[model samples]
Target chain A: MNKRNKLLIRKTLISIVMVLIVIVSLFPIYWMLLTSVQPRHELMNYPPNFYTRHPTLEFWKFTFKESILEFFNSLVIAFFATIAAIICGATSGYAFARYKVGGDTLPFWILSLKFFPPVVAIVPYFLMMRTLRLIDTCTAVIITHMIITVPFAVWMIKGFIQEVPRELEEAAMIDGCSQLNVIRIITLPIIAPGLVVTALFCFIWSWNDFMFALILTRNKAMTIPVAIAGMREAHGLMWGEVSATAALGTIPIIIMAIILQKYLVRGLSLGSIK
Target chain B: MTVKKRALMLVLPTVVVLALIVIFPLVFSLSVSVRAYDIRIPEHPFIGFGNWISLLKNPDFYSAVLVTGTMILAELFFELLLGLCVALLLLQLPRSRKIFQPILLIPMMVMPVVVGYMGRLVFEVRSGPINYFLNMLGLESLCWHASPDLALITILILRIWRWTPFVMAVLLAGLLSLPMEPYQSAQVDGANIWQIFIHITIPMLKPIITLVVIMRSLEILQTFDIMYVLTMGGPGAKTMTLSLYAYITGFRYWDIGQASAAAWLIMIPLSIMVTLFVKMMEKGEKIEQAK
Candidate 1:
């Protein structure tokens, strides 16, 4: 075959595999959305409707009625945690990038802290919360959730901060701007995209947490994930409502993830890719 | 203030917060791990290595280790293999890359707890889509998580489904960022696609391969939500990873001492891997700066 023929074959092969890859990647998420809207009978019906022509909102209604509180709790906690993480992370990131705070090991120490299994911390965290009389409260969960997000935030924001040319900040400093003012005027704007990416990714991560909320909060501050998981109790499984709750917890993140797709690789890799 | 002092001041809040929430809690967890303390029990006493000794003797702890080891290896192998193929495929068509990349990441975005519930529904042997599709292809119904043999396999499938996009994202980024000089040289020298991939791509991508492996392994070692939701560490502890096992021991069984031991056991290997990853990253950065 000619080189042109071979290239054609390879491109066709790539097209075929990509089609399959896209389908497998999308089907489950599509199924979750489908099952959430399907009425009870259609949900359990044999040879399940691949597409629900007569979709019903009953399952979503039940899901909202049961889980609206947990959803809000997750919203409040994840949102606040992101804000806290970004503030601390950006400043710490600035220090690490600019001043090499503490020592050479300080930033790595912070990153390594993130890799420590939450299981290790769970026992003490729960005990600490109990000791401080903060167990089963949003404040308690937010404090711990920060543990998950802060290091990631710092690393990501550090990468973004490092990208800002030092000369710009120095120029600002020479013109009588203080260090804080230099950061506010010069660094923050340049790294604002990174900060947004870090915040969004941090929010999704804190929202997706199950172990922390599962261990720390029982009833009052139960997050959406735990509440969604609770639908699959021992005796019975509420598939429809489970699907609905999963959809509720996932859709917004999926949308934001799509919007931030370009930054996600950087965010997920903790800036190693850049 | 001098810049150094101001910098330290800038770092202070994060350092303090992490100390209180992260570092302090870990130390506190270690101390708790050495004691026979259960919230339910009135008399909590220091049991000095008793929990660790007892945990080492327990068969279930080994099972958790074995299960977690297999999970990390299998997840890494399959996700990397498939992710590489798709990533290479994506690299072929820059025009279509942006359009399809976001679609590919949908699975990665769905919450793990939700994936567990969704997996339970989709893999239901009686009426699930998987078995239904299999039956369409003339295979008999096979129980997934309910079968002791298939439970971990089921979990691995769900994990790969969710995480392959992540692996692909990293590797694809690695692939796209390659210098192109080697590939151009290889093509000019009449190298085939496989030849270039083996001789150039693999060697160039080795660092990233190790990176994704270590990172993903660290994550897989902490497996909990999916197992908790789907099997509850059953059909008979067949699918229990260390994280779930620790959670069960600490929270469910209320054996704080033993649970903390199990948690620490998981942490040792994890800590070693993390240290190695940081060192490699530092070396890579050093080499880049030298260049």
Candidate 2:
């Protein structure tokens, strides 16, 4: 074969493999969506339908009936938690980026806190929340979820802020703008996109949390993942309801994931990428 | 205010928040570990490592450690391999990276709880797609999460599926940002593709590979939601990771003292390792930047 043909064949093979990876990666989620709408009997058939022949709104209703509250709970909690995380994370990120807060050591120590396992702190957290009569409340869930997202937000925003050179802020400062005003007028606008990405990530982390919501909330403020756990109790595992709830829980993040694709490398690596 | 005070004002909220939520919990949980503090028990007394002693003797704890160890190792191996392959492939086809990158990230975005339940639904022995596809291919069906032998594998498969894209993303970023002079120089030296990849690509990607490995392993060590929803670390404790074991003990069994002990058991070593590892990462990044 000619050299050009060899390259063509190689390209085709790579495309084929890429197609396979895409399918494998995305099929489970598609399967989950399909299972959510599959008729009850259809779900348990000898082989579950690859495509639902007779899709139903039954499982959606059954799952969403109880899940709607939890869904909203998840949304509200994640929103508030992201706000808390951003407010704290952005300021600290700015401080670290601009002021070199505590020199390099302090920020790494704080960043290391991100790696601390949930298992270690959760038992005490549960007790603390209980003592404050905060169990099963949105406040408790939001606070606990904030623990996970804040480090992420700080690290992410720090990178974004660092990318905005000190010259811009210095120009403002030289114009007699106070440090605070320099931040408000120049830094905030510059890092706003980064903040949005960081906040979206915080929102997803809060929304996707099962461990915190499971331990922190009971009925009053049960989040969507907790609602899935609740399904496990009613029936052995309502595959349909579980699928429906899982699909519902992931829809927001899936949308956000697409939007944040460009930023995800930076976000997921906690700004290590940049 | 002086610049220092202004900086403090910017950073104080974060420090206070971390103190309350992060550091306080560390000290508090460690304290709980030393005491006989089960919610089931009426009296709370400082036993001074009695809980730790009992947990050391607990067979369930050992089993959990074994399962978690196996799972983490397996996931680290598979995700790195698969993620590296996909990353290399995407790098080869730069034009298609845009089309494929977002789709590949869908699994990473899917909720872990959703991953757990979705694992159950998609891998169910009798009616799951795996078995169905297997039977269609004229192969005998194998029980996935239901079988003890396969439970960890099922979890690993799902874990890798969720995270390989993460590995791929980070690696892709690393690949994309790789300094070009080395490759061009290597080419001028008449290095073959294999030789160039071995010397130049691998060396340049080392920091990212290390980061992905350490980060993913730490996560797999704490793998809980999947085992919880999919198997409850069950089929005779075949899949009980340390986190799940601690969770079950602390929450379900209400054995707070032992749970606290187990949590510390995971945490203490983990803290040392992670701190050191993160420091290495910082050092590595500095070296990379300097180069």
lDDT of 1 by residue, B204-236 (tens): 999999999999999998989899988988988
Model 1 chain B worst lDDT window (10 residues):
B280-289
* Model 1, residue pairs in steric clash: none
Distance from true location, Cα of A187 in model 1, Å: 1.5
Cα lDDT tens digits, model 2, A95-202, are 898888888787787778777788887898899998899998999888877777887788778778878988988898899999778888998998898899989889
Candidate 1 C-alpha lDDT tens digits along A1-274? 6998998898788878888889987888888888888878787678877988889988899878988999999999999999999999988898898887876688888888778688888998888888889988999889888988998898778778777888998898899999778878788888888889999998999999999999888888999998887767732777778888889999999999987988888888877886
DockQ per candidate, 2 decimals: 0.81, 0.77
Model 1 chain A weakest 10-residue run by lDDT: A230-239
Across all candidates, what is each one's fraction of true contacts kept? 0.83, 0.85
lDDT, residue A273, candidate 1: 88
- Superposed by TM-score, candidate 2 places the C-alpha of residue A138 at a distance from the truth, in angstroms, of 1.0
